[model samples]
Target chain A: MVRYLSAALLVASLFWLAGCGSSGVSFNGKDITGLMPDLEFSLKGEGGETVTQARYQGEAVVLFFGYTHCPDFCPTTLTALAQALNKLSDQEREQIRVLFVSVDPERDTPELLAKYTAYFSPRVDGLTGDQETLRELTKRYRTTYSYGEPNESGAYLVNHGLAMYGFDRHGKVRLFMRNDQPVDQIAEDLRALVSIQ
Target chain B: MLHTLYGALTPYIFSPITVLLFLLAVTAYLVGWRRLAARGRPPSAWRSLSFFLGVLLCYLVMHTQFDYYSRYMFFVHRGQHLVLHHLGAFLIALANPLPVLAACAGDRHFPRLAAVLRPVRRVLFDPVVATVLFVGLIFFWLSPSIHFDAMLSLRLYELMNWSMLVDGVIFWLVILDPRDPDRAHTSRFGVRFLMLVAALFPQILLGAYITFADAGLYDVYAICGRAFAIDAATDQVLGGLLTWIPPAMMTIVGALVVLRLYLRYDSEKGG
Candidate 1:
């Protein structure tokens, strides 16, 4: 029993050394596995239906972490997502859905967020909720954020990792796209990911 | 100054070296666009290199202006600033193109950077940020007291290099960032048109200053300066060209890039 406990302690120390324990993401969350932590979410999209892990299953989804109030990065990224979609052939474009989840739920109401997403692309959907639900999803995606930095204003910024998750038609996470990975590369990667199944 | 400008204007400046370097750049660009160039615009490296060289050429022009001004005529100095900041800066920026580093790095490094920038790239790449910075820098530099200070102090010479070389590169990056929504959100017609106009202002101001100044701006280029066979009047015209011609070429080329982008899409209205 003592030997087994020592082995466990050694593994735990390794994880702690790597800093994954301090991360808000599930310590068990797999970075390369095509599986997001099966969290339930309600996206204000497509007739305002409640979206969950099952709904995204068997569909290709491109997900982003952002807020409506973001002047530079958030809105621009959403637009690029839209443009990349638009660049695809009709068949390819039809098979994909872009999700914009607001990290700031305090101000980004569903209706306001919906309006912002609609301006860029109709196929784009916005998601937001109370802190509890937001925290749950952010954990599953391994996204990190903080409030009120470099100033005392109510304004806050998210310093989350900027990778796009590509879930195949199986709803399994298949690939990750780094920020500004070029329109063509993302498009080709998506095509390959979708064609896999 | 007139003699120097004359020497620069002669054929050697536009020699086979320009063409050879441009062609070498073309080859590099071809390699750069391994995927897209075949199908779409063959993203031209020649154009970008030309822009880089144009900025360097303007740096040389500033050298001449410095030589002209040490003797105390202020108008030529002012004209030089106008040239370097707006005209020279924009043309250089437009010509050099943007994210050349991204293009050169290829598929692997790009994704990592993209991931890093995903949440934050837009802010750094925003056209408005560059526009505001450039406009603000010019606004600050244009203040009369500042102008007087730049003329009197040796540091303004260095500062001019910063505004023209550094700030110039950044502002042009935005104006030319085709993928940047903050920039493209303007819609091509208005954005490109505005870019040209904003680019043209400094050049126009410089010519007006030189032509209208009551006394010569630089002591070095005073009436008593060495009389060249070409004469000072002709040299001033060369200054105007140095300020205006390269920018005009850049703008026309920029318009072409924008128009080509628009036309490519317009023709693809199969959707």
Candidate 2:
């Protein structure tokens, strides 16, 4: 009986240990290392050319999903991201890229996206895709987006994810930053993520 | 139009294990029902209907596009668990499927399989173990940190759902066993009643805690975005109500069933 009890205790402790597994680097954001798939998507880039995850190879990528017309979350989060990037050293900033993928392909053309993303930072790229591609990408990441009914003025709301996913240099998913995280903490986490290699 | 309907009906995440288990169960039940009918000992239609409805409800929640909403919305996830862990499992146990399943097995094939499963069943069906698992799983998965991880990881998410489902079936089966404890050595009806009541309070406490909390207990839905635009607090409250009310009602319903069983057994002995 004692032997069986010890075995059960050992097994329970092993599960507890497994549940607490981490990547050894702390961040203000939720550590999601190995919990999600590597970054991958094919979308229309701001240059009117097809772009894929391959273009961002060898750089840390932050991916956020929203509509260009998102009145609050999009602009606020982008601004916060810009501020976070400003806190990083130029050398650290050089290694980071932020991809803002608009889910409203009908309204957000490449030119509009380019202008919108450029307002934030040169390192930020705007991309949008057809509904099918967007659905696939969002589903892969276990997030989703949906458009609301258009009102009298032809404006509609597009609900999208507020958290940003951070991928390491090798494109392995590593962190998830919530919209409420502070700019300084975001920058600190980015700095730690940058030094992972 | 048909294409859109088909897309909605198709599974959000297909699992062969789930499909196979469901198919095998349906086939076995049908075969056994036919055999029993031939023997003039068929179960009541209501019981069979309960079994099929229970199985189908579980399948629909886990396999259909409903799963997508459950993943992205807190309230829907709670509803899915309500069906899986309470209503669906309750109906299935109420159907008393063991006799039908045993008839299908017929003591001919898979003796070794039965031998292997016997010890496993013994451990799982222990009254204490069953009660702990039934309540503990709800608490375990709803822990904010664990809930966040389960929502993110596909494998963990699947495990979480399947565990709740399997544990629910085991727990309800223990409580709703049709055999008389004096004759069949099953759990005493009083013990089953205690298990139901024991499992009830923790759930009520947790649900009340979630409902009345000032802030969102689960951030995964916000992080992943919702199926539509709804306030986080509203969503949490709805999820909390789902967690609180229906399950407590199910516990009462289960207690009533045990009481009826006890009364029936007492009369049988007296008469």
Best by lDDT: 2
Residues A1-197, model 2: lDDT tens digits: 44344435633653563363455789999888878888998999998899999999989999999978899999999999999999999999999999999999999999999999999999899999999999899988889988899999999999888889998888888889998899999999888778777
* Least well predicted 10-residue stretch by lDDT in candidate 2 chain B: B105-114
In model 1 chain B, where is the ten-residue run with the lowest total lDDT?
B219-228
Candidates' C-alpha lDDT? 0.54, 0.88
Q: Interface RMSD of candidate 1?
A: 30.7
- Lowest lDDT sum, 10 consecutive residues, model 2 chain A, at A2-11
Model 1, backbone clash pairs (residues 3+ apart or across chains), number? 15
Kindly report which residue stretches of model 1 are placed more than 4 angstroms away from their true locations once superposed. A1-197, B1-45, B48-52, B55-59, B62-83, B86-92, B104-129, B177-188, B195-257
| DockQ versus reference, model 1 | 0.01
Interface RMSD of each: 30.7, 3.2
